[model samples]
Target chain A: MSRLAAKFEELAQSGRKALIPFITAGDPSPGFTVPMMHAMVKAGVDVIELGVPFSDPMADGPVIQRASERALAHKMSLRRTLEIAAEFRKTDQTTPVVLMGYLNPIEAMTYEGFANAAQRADIDGVLTVDLPPEEGQECSALLKARGIDPIFLLAPNSSVDRVKKMDAVGSGYLYYVSLKGVTGAGHLDVADVENKLQQIRANTQLPVAIGFGVKDAETANTIAHLGDGVVIGSALISKIETNLDNPEQAKNEIVELLTSIRQALDCGLGTEGVQE
Target chain B: MTEKYNMPDERGHFGPYGGIFVAETLIPPIQELNAAYQKYLKDPEFIAELDADLKYYVGRPSPLYHAERWSRELGGAQIYLKREDLNHTGSHKINNTVGQALLAKRMGKTRIIAETGAGQHGVATATVAARLGLECVVYMGAVDVARQSLNVYRMKLLGAKVVAVESGSKTLKDALNEALRDWVTNVDNTFYIIGTVAGPHPYPAMVRDFQAIIGREAKQQCLEATGRLPDALVACVGGGSNAIGLFYPFIEDESVKMYGVEAAGDGVATGRHSAPLCAGRPGVLHGNRTYLMADDDGEIIETHSISAGLDYPGVGPEHAWLKDTGRATYVNITDTEALEGFYALTHMEGIIPALESSHAMAYALKLAPTMGKDETLIINLSGRGDKDMQTMAKREGIEL
Candidate 1:
């Protein structure tokens, strides 16, 4: 099994909701990225999502867009992002790192190049926001051949028919965007998400992760109760932006938020020995 | 003459401006377009469809009307207007959209996607999609959704799905972002119907070729009416499709001077301008290397213009090439000046032109007074201003 699948299975067996923290690589600089990954893992994050910055990020909101801009200002490319992952793997090998970004950069590098680079860098999975499963056959096949799970996003606007289509190609955890617009624009419609999750669960046996607007602890806890995993992006990027001038403080703040969410999910799961 | 039509010199320069400065993924596609266009230009079927559509649907042979009153008011030259505003969908934008949609059908693509600002291009794409029975998706900025709600409704009514993008600055540039994302995802079965001459290689060339009908007809009409071609050809330069179309056929005619008018919201010196050719430097934007108003760090600066259609910071690569080669001159017209021309044309000639075309009218107003009485000038009236009526009324403090 892939690292992402194993992590999901372990969380399922423990009856614990997985906590995923998203960070854009090279936001502060390449020098600070590996340490930041270590910090998130130490704070009890079950999965780490590293964002590969693209010149045009359409699905991201203002906070993440700002973070991407900062990264791009440093001339962050896919090669540099993978190098950061490779550096992190030297110290820590167990944490599952999934590269989440738009498809342009990956497409800019051919599918074979991306698959080989991800494998060599110890990257476990990829979730391209714009690459739907129906159109990702070549990339998915390439990644699957190399044991890297290709994750897909299912949204409220996606129909049951579309969910079945995604199920055929989607592996590892399926990301469920709670809203229709870009990330961080609106409040989470919990009922709408729950209904969509239930519909998606009926179609696919893959683990479902809810994202897009789970900002505070309350929303994260609520979403964790209904879904297999919770993905946090804009709020984490906002924290990093607040403490950007001081890297240590920024890492501390991000870890604090992840720790609190991890503890809350553990409490809901009734897991006795899970570390927060 | 044949050399004039050929493109991309040894160094990828289109008269010293255009070049392929794109991601490696797009290299194959750009090369494919170059090869396809070369062959397609000679194909009888391709020429037939394009000609038939231009004649029947686009209402080609748009008249060259003598604006006698406005010309007399200028007190010098006899000015004429090429009436592209009379085309279907109320703008010259339809000409390129129809051609690209037909190409998409020929390429065996079943889905089409486009990006829009004031929704002129969206309406044009939706119209062609409905005609061709292709599924259409339009990406528009959230701010534009509120401003151009009627056009959005029109697009939906024509059976196209409109996705409002609330990212970046929430403008035309952001709409372009979403459309790029959609194109990358569905590239296999989808054809991106780029509306302007600003994207990667063949798009700039293809859109210009489709719009070239404007200059071809205008040149004939001007010669028939005045026994000689106009001394000057003026047109607005937002992405430069209409301007290039009206200027290409006349490029070899040294007697006819060409002027491209860009939008100057306040003034070019104030940094609140869309004068890409007048003030911008060479840069890559929207997949094509062109002249763009970029900052010290090469980041695209936000442009200001009263006309949403003219608010982009980058001009088409072909226009940049034309400007560099000294084949065409570019100038800036302020919002106030364009507004004056807008009202002047509406009352004087009974033609309410698009705010974009009004920029050209404003330039003509300035140039006509300086020319001799024997001199004739032609200005491209690119589109009707009905879509901008509400904005104009609001700006004039008139309530709906």
Candidate 2:
């Protein structure tokens, strides 16, 4: 199993939900990205989703888009993003960093090159927002051969048959988009998500992580109680964008926010077990 | 002047304005389109099908009518209208949509996806999808959803799933974003029916090629009627599809000057303009390297226009190339000027034009007064004003 999958399985068996914090790499600057990733890991994040900035991020909300824009402005190409991961790997290797972005950058780097780069960078997995499983067989095979998991998203609109097809191809974990619209638009219909989760659980034994509009601790806790993992992206990016000039403070604030949600998921005693 | 047209290179770069700069995931599909287009261009079967569709379905060879009343009122140059509005679906957008839909069928794609601003293209795409028995999905901005509910319903009625995109300013750009996302995800089985002569690679060239029929027909009609081409040819430039279509055949005709009027929503000086050719610089937007309005920081700013169709912050790359090469001149027409021209055309000639087309009309009005009486001008009436009637009525304080 991939490190991400193994981690999720461990958490699932222990009756603990995975806390996944997403941050756009090189947002504000690359200088702070590694530190931010480390801080999230320290703050009780189980899986870290490192977003690779793209010029047109259609699936993202304004907050994440602005964060991506900031990163791209600093010339955050896919090569630079991989370099950041390589740097991050020098000090830490067990965090299971998954590079999440659109397919253009990966395609720009040929499948073999990208798989090799991911292996060198110590990337645990990849989840392209736009590349569906049916078309991703080659990429999946290459990444799998290199021991990098290839994750896929399952939307509410995605049929059960389609989810099963993705389940056959996907590794690490399945990302369930909580809403039909783009990130951060609608209120989370928790009931709808619960129903979809039930449907997904019936077809695949893969660990499912719910993202899109999981803003506050309450919603995070609610999603954690149901799914194996909870992914927070737009809300975290919004905070980072709001405090861009002082990234340290933004980092602290995000760590604190995730800590609170982690505590909530653990019923208020999660901080006592921090290794650091 | 060259009698035969030269094909643009594989990159779709029409002199530096157009090129495929899309994501890696879309490259294979773009290449497929390029190959398909090259083959289809030479195939008599494809041409016959498209020709028949244009003639019967889109009501092609639309009449070039002399606007005698408007010309007499202007009292300078003779004015004529290339009536593209008379085509089915009430706009020039159907011309490209139908052609692309046919191409999509030839490519063995099962689904069609498109993005729309004013919902005109969405309706056009959905109409073609319905006709061709393909599943269609259209992405429209949530803001546009509110503004163009009728078109939204029209698209749905024609058997398309309309997705309201609420991200990134919740406008046309956002709709384009969602559509791009969809295309990336479904590129294997889906054909992205780009509404304009924009985007990466084959799209700009393909859309322009389809739309170029306008200029080809107008040129023949104008010469037959007046014994010479018009002194000036005018059309509005959003992504420059309609304008390029109307301007392409006349590029080599030095005496027949071509004008692409952009929407100066407030004014170019105020930075609230859509005049990308006149004011924008080279930048990457929507997967294509093109001329776009960008701040000193290279950030794309929001553009404003009374006409949603002309509200984009970028022009088609070909227009930027044409401007640089001196084959075409780009001009800006302000909202007030376009509005005034809208009323003038309606009152004088009893023809209501889309606000986008009014930009060209406004420019024609400005140029008519200085021209000799014998000089004639042709304007591409790209679309009917029915879509804008509600907004126009509200702006004019009409009860309806």
**Under CAPRI classification, how is model 1 graded?**
incorrect
Error of 1 at A72 (Å): 8.8
Model 1 residue A96 CA deviation in Å: 20
Off by over 4 Å in 1: A1-66, A69-276, B1-5, B9-12, B24-35
- Per-residue lDDT of B216-242 in model 2, one digit per residue for the tens? 999999999999988999899998889
> Where does the lowest 10-residue lDDT sum fall in candidate 1 chain B?
B21-30
Clashing pairs in 1: none
lDDT of each: 0.83, 0.84
Q: For each candidate, report its DockQ versus the true two-chain complex.
A: 0.06, 0.09
lDDT of 2: 0.84
